[model samples]
Target: MLNDLPIRKIIHVDMDAFYASVAQLDNPELRGKAIAVGGGGARGVISAASYEARKFGVKSAMSGRLAIKLCPELIFVKTNFDRYNEISKKVRHIFHDYTDLVEPLSLDEAYLDVTANKKGNPSASLLAQEIRNRISTEVGLTASAGISINKFIAKVASDYNKPNGQKTVNPEEVLQFLEDLDIRKFYGVGKVTAEKMYQKGIFTGQDLKGKSLEYLEDHFGKSGSYYYHVVRGIHNSDVKPNRIRKSLAAERTFSENLSSEIFMLEKLDHITEEVVKRLKKSKVSGKTITLKIKYSDFTLQTRSKTLPYFVSEKSIILETAKDLLFQEKMSNSVRLLGISLSNLNTETSKIKVLEAKEKAVSVQLKFEF
Candidate 1:
């Protein structure tokens, strides 16, 4: 079965310290310094830290207080999504120059299928090098590239050499590489799953591959099938170029927490306006509205309501979000409020329909080996 699958040239490109790097690139003084990009306070969190700051154990999603304790000299810069988005678009344009089959996971990373790219370059490794060089020259930011036969291996290899480097796993070396890889390093195996695998004495890809298909299935359900095949160098998930946007959201944290319902309503209305504006800009509407609240005590709550029809107008979003907000009783003074729209109507709906038809047809074609 593995031999029947066609080989593909996939490349995963990831930016190094994207947010912190951009901050340094735009501000000369921040270059070569320990910096963290995010809010800095008791309620703040680090979004991204430069390599210098990381030396002191500062990392994204860590509390700002903890980050500061680790590196007192760490400079914190507020996030600028608009600026990041602009730079990300420029980076993506470079990818498009090579291949249209680019699947962006985020602003900082993407997977490219260059098996039949416009460049006519048969070497995926060389193409990855060219892409990295172009990004460094044109965008003034560093990126790491990993070239392999599949997306999973490419993504894993991209992280092997951090900051700025590239790794290529040739077709012949794929099995040996997979067999030697640590179970924790396999994509989709989170901390919990890794711990579970550890307890079961399955600490490496070889151990996982040794498990019977029935045993894996009994242990991990559907994911067991994934592990069963992936350990033997099989991952058929394509780099979907037309991945749909699941949701759109806007939120803000207040410097001073608000306890008054009137003040909360006012803030919700403001957030709703921001969300509606983004929806309009995206040219999409949704039937599901969600209201998120963060309290001064650091507790969080969310209320969501799905409507019968799609709506994107500011007034309607505001009214619906307000209703959802009021439905939940405040447990503490609010520090943050957010509004979002989901169940979006777009080309994604058509794609889903097509996929469903394809799946139905394939179900009848399936045969046991």
Candidate 2:
């Protein structure tokens, strides 16, 4: 089944602790020290943690106070977006030297399709090493890469080795590699999903592969099919260079919790205006409007309505948001409120769809990269 499919060389490059590393790069005093970027205040949340901080169980999204409890000597630095963006551009410039098929997942990571590269390099593994080396030398930051036949496998392989490392899963080894993979390591499986898979006795890719498609679908709904295919090394999604924006959102976290609906309505108007401004700047409209509420306790709730036609006007969006807001009573005092528009006009058909099962092609035994 694997032999007949078309093969492409894909590399997923992820920077190691980007924000914290960047903070260290510019400040020699911060180097080799436990440092976290952002989350310096009473209500602050850590954005990124350095390797030194990570050793003490400090990590991104953990509260600043808790991070301090874990690593008492942890240093907190303010986020510098301009500096991060400047360095990110330098890294991306290096990527373009190899291939134009670069799809940036964030300022710190991207996927590059090097099947047909400008350098004519056949070995994706070597290309990954060269790219990492360049990043280290030119940008002064380390990176980890995963090289494989498809995006899914490549993404997973990149993490096998962390903090300055690379892993290559050759075409022939794809099956065994995935089968041996821990179920929790699959990219899309989060904590809740991993627990669910464990309860179903799916502990590894091999275990997931054993379940029939119907059995998986019955238990896992739409995601069950995804699990069944990915375990079999059947992911055919292309690396899209021009990925479309799926949604646009604007939100505000209040300094103090607002308990009154009237005050919430005033905040929603401002958020709706920001959303409209962004939508107009992007030249896109959306059919769906979603209202997000985050209570003081940090619990989140979202209400969405998909309209028959697209809308980008502030008045229309505000009206829809108000409707969704009033539809549900407040569960608790709200700390945050947001408005988002999805199902945008910019969405189009995918560049390539997953090939049908019956389709067959000649195998490239060499598997160059």
Candidate 3:
């Protein structure tokens, strides 16, 4: 039904090894080597590791001791989430420039609803390219993008190329793309799910498209609903516009350019305190810390880090942001400083989750209506 419906433009963005890549970018010594961010201690779990480290069998959530055994020279640095979180915000704002319909999957990936984009662009593929270019040039990070008529196909397209890559599935090409797709390549199709599909003689999208809706529901239960839509190459999910304010942050433009380290920290403390006050009133708890800086010549940068758990303390947020600021010596004077906390745990998000299910039903009802 979706394939037959009037085609709408969509884009999916996925960042490659975001945390580890950023570390390699800032520190030239770690580039092209098996670098894992975490400790070599017995309990240290790899928070993020470079692609090079992955080849050595290193992976996130794996123990550091095991990682070293895989790659003897495996470099392990303790995670500094304060920096990564800051960069997340910078990229998000950049995405907003193209479209307001952005659904962030995590710190590194998102789905963009670009059907009626602000840029007046007709081609979704061209829009995806422009967005990827801005991310690399403005944010100093490479990102992979996928463009298609719907979110499901867009997501599949983005991963076709690795870092700094993009691909598109236009209306005319959708059927061919689906015909050649492996069942495993479909998102949400786990190995177990794929094996089950294989049992049902479904190895590809063509096989899947041949199955009747009732037969699919009888075999796959709830997943049948998802699959029925996927075969047609669309995810009927809407981009949620209700952006719950997790952390309130403000940036002030300084009359005089400030270059001193102590000056930066002093400004950070003030901004962080403002964030904490908003968190308290909103009854929010977040462990991740983010810092944003704007240069006088208009170059912008951000850094952030996520903590093991949620915390809304002013001292903790400020300290984390302060560490990131100090890590990058402010050679050029900074014009503005801002702070925000993500991975936040709030009652608002909890409430929004409940609403999402109702919203999904409402979306379906719209078509029925």
Cα lDDT, model 1, residue 345: 93
* Residue-by-residue lDDT tens digits, candidate 3, 167-263: 8887778877987899999988998999999999999999999998898999999999789777777676666544565665656556578888788
Candidate 1 residues 47-147, lDDT tens each?
99999999999999898889888898989998888899999999999998987778899999999977766676778888999999999999999999988
Candidate rank order under lDDT: 2, 1, 3
Q: What is the lDDT of candidate 1?
A: 0.87
* lDDT agreement of model 3 with the native: 0.79
lDDT per residue, candidate 2, 89-161, as tens digits?
Answer: 9999999898767789988999998777767677889999999999999999999999999899999999989
Ranking by TM-score: 1, 2, 3
Off by over 4 Å in 3: 243-369
Each model's TM-score, in the order given? 0.89, 0.83, 0.66
Output the lDDT of residue 285, model 3. Answer: 80
| Model 1: residues with Cα > 4 Å off, grouped in runs | 253-259, 294-300, 331-335, 348-369
**Winning model by lDDT:** 2
- In model 2, the clashing pairs are none
Preferred candidate (lDDT higher): 1 or 3:
1
Please give the distance, in angstroms, between residue 109's alpha carbon in candidate 3 and its true position after superposition.
1.1
